[model samples]
Target: MSAPRGWRPAELVADRFETASARTLRLRVADWPGHLPGQHIDVRLTAPDGYHAERSYSLAAPFDGEFVEITVQRVTDGEVSGYLVDGLPVGASIEIRGPVGGWFVWDPARPAPAVLVAGGSGIVPIAAMLRARRKAMADSPFRVVYVLRDPGSLFYRDELADEEIFLAYTRAAPPGDPRLPGRLTLEELREHTLPPGPEVTCYVCGPTGFVEATAAQLVSLGHAPGAVRTERFG
Candidate 1:
């Protein structure tokens, strides 16, 4: 993919969601270029006196060549997020850059059995991966295990209702759900059946602790360290 025409201001057009806590922001860029799944853009906001703050957000929707969608979670003290949730509005303008970062991207051409592990809002990039996979009509072996507090907070609730997805809740239990009750653990992961072979690739995204612990567990479970890719958000 070509580089996005450098950083520029974009207009916020809409914000809605599959759940309340998670929101998808639709931005109208001047040029409206395409980006790879798993990439992020840098958002910049300025104070009245020119003091500025910035944050990097992963794209939640597939690159459609016309608009960009970013999923944001409201963080208690997060400057960018707080502004986005409260101060920003439809028709608001914001400065953003990229189509940046490539370490976590999924390429349909090199499809492999993939295991996606997400915690909280970390599912953003995984959502992009799903869209990309579907667009390519690639039957790449793939499965997603999303861990959250409860259904009320699941980022892409409706999208994940499909049979191919799995949920692990740490706080509230879904009625008749058979998966484990607590946070994801190596033991529980081991109990779940996975496709055979060492070639299976693992993609993990979430808070720092969850990503680190899960990657360690995958390595110990015989998955190649090289095959286990990770992206962590604080």
Candidate 2:
């Protein structure tokens, strides 16, 4: 398939801290074509020496006019992530091309129940799906399972408060939290997720290992292999 038009200029109009190491940047792109939920953009940064660095970031919200949002997680020794999280100023400029990827996207018209499994920064696209659903006022049910290192690492905490989210804290738990700190177990997964059915679709995104393991668990729980979709990133 053909790709998006050549990189267009984008300017960071606003930003907010999701965590100490992650930030959500809102960019206004020239001639933006708009994007579906779960799509991503390729961002390019050029230095004074004419060096160019590029990275892919998932859209963090549904389409909004000529503006788009992406959440960046700071990675140690990462060429693009580090600058996106800490170095890039609010008004700085970059180039972006996308609305990339057709699969792993949620359609508001489809009534199938959705199961979203997200690990760390993988929640960005999933969050976009949720936002899109709300914007469309669709009645399709959605269940979200987010895995994080601790309470402090949770993204979009305020916005997700009323959503049906099952959070698993791996390394630490806040005071009064019921679940203990540990990796998500199969038993816990079964307890939180919907029973596999013909009309249910599962979307898992995260690190490669996490996505693979989670998808396997879903299949083992009787979910059809084709019904389980996944997207993984480093």
Candidate 3:
């Protein structure tokens, strides 16, 4: 439960996507320590006069080794994502503290049946959980339902295309896509048929409104309240 050692950002590299909305930043730190999947790191920026701002971003890469990968989605007025997407460059340094947070982490040693619900940028941490699951060969049962506006805006498309995975689009449709279209509704969730018992753990993350609505729907569909765990990002 202790905070992972903090490190200074030692380098930054840009990864441009076909869509301008998504970009991956590879951050290198000086003596960066390892972190469990689903843990997040804090990035802090300061003004010339030393006034500061910070944000917590989940690690997107697998937990195999050194360096951390954080995939950031630009928010309209977000200081961190705005700078990370448009201004920060390789070799730029910043103050970072983490791997912080405990409630959302997915430990390989204790994998359990999991249901992950992500909306938009909320997929960051869930992606890391998947990586850890794959690496550890954890027998934890898994199902992910990622709700996004459209296919073009999806964070990790190909990596989550398994039959067990479901993508619910609330906005535009994906061509030739057979998955459901529209927001995730309580009825739809019930139709999907979750782990059919009380043993499943549901993890939901997204904007505040989405998390609340989804958690409500899950509970309404007979999922035990104690079995549902959530994290919200504004």
Candidate 4:
């Protein structure tokens, strides 16, 4: 599959709910150019009256064939996200243009240790990087720190179970877990994330506030400013 130049037709082939408000969609794009880990795609939906709604979603997995997967987080009153999460049916058609973005991607060839920090649905792209790393059989050390409102809101729960992942719950912690429910603290970052160093590359994604705050924490811990890469959404 080569990357299509503009918007191309995508047919929904599979769909599943990852959380109460998030759904993963698998679409087969005939001309889909494979995407790098951490790249995103633009999805567009058109109404019968010529109304259009568009949104960008991060790729959820490494490209294997003509299909691409995206996990959509339903916003409170979001048009595109709402439809993609709840209304789009299997076999339906949508337009997609992508493999967009380059700055946030992870290259398996890099030998530096990776620290992934995700908030809410931000795990979508991080999961792709993790999957790509495994697919490539890279030996670089990788760590993940994920923060969500509760256990129920965590995406890829089953898929990421065996990875080197740490969790921080904001509203509720699972039974037997020692940490109480609260926002991610600097202490947690210091304890769970890779030690500050030049050879460590950090990727942080989530809502704008979370990305900014987490990046600041990493810098405060002595990581070089240029070594930290970030992507943010609502």
Candidate 3 or 1, higher lDDT: 1
List all candidate RMSDs to the true structure. Answer: 1.9, 1.5, 2.3, 1.6
The parts of candidate 2 lying over 4 Å away from their true place are 1-3
Report the C-alpha lDDT of model 1 over 47-97, residue by residue, as the tens digit.
899998999999988787668899888888888887887678899888888
Q: How close is candidate 4 to the true structure, as a TM-score?
A: 0.96
Give the clash count for model 3: 0
For model 3, the superposed segments whose C-alpha errors exceed 4 Å read 5-7, 13-18, 196-198
Q: Clashing pairs in model 1?
A: none
**Which stretches of candidate 4 lie above 4 Å from their native place?**
1-4, 109-111
Best by lDDT: 2
Q: Whole-model lDDT for model 4 versus the true structure? A: 0.90
lDDT of 2: 0.91
How close is every model to the real structure, measured as TM-score?
0.91, 0.96, 0.89, 0.96
Across 1-234, the per-residue lDDT of candidate 4 in tens digits comes to 235489989999999999989999999999666888889999999999999888999999987679999999999999999999999999999999988888888876564588999999999999999998999888888889999998899899888898889999999988998989999999889889889776789999999999999999999988999989999997
| lDDT at residue 75 of model 3 (Cα atoms) | 82
Query: Would you list the rank order by TM-score, best first?
Result: 2, 4, 1, 3
Candidate 3 lDDT by residue in tens digits, 1-234: 347665565467445542466577777765666787778888898889988889888888765444778887888988888887778777787778877877777777778788888999889888888888988988778888888888788887667765366778998878887765788887667666465466688888899999999988888877888888888987
Total clashing residue pairs per candidate? 0, 0, 0, 2
TM-score of 3: 0.89
Q: Write the per-residue lDDT of candidate 2 for residues 1-234, one digit (tens) a residue.
A: 234888898999999999999999999987788788888989998888999999999999988889999999999999999999999999988899887898888876565688999999999999999999999998887889999999899999899998989999999998998999999999888988989988899999999999999999999999999999999996
Residue pairs in clash, model 2: none
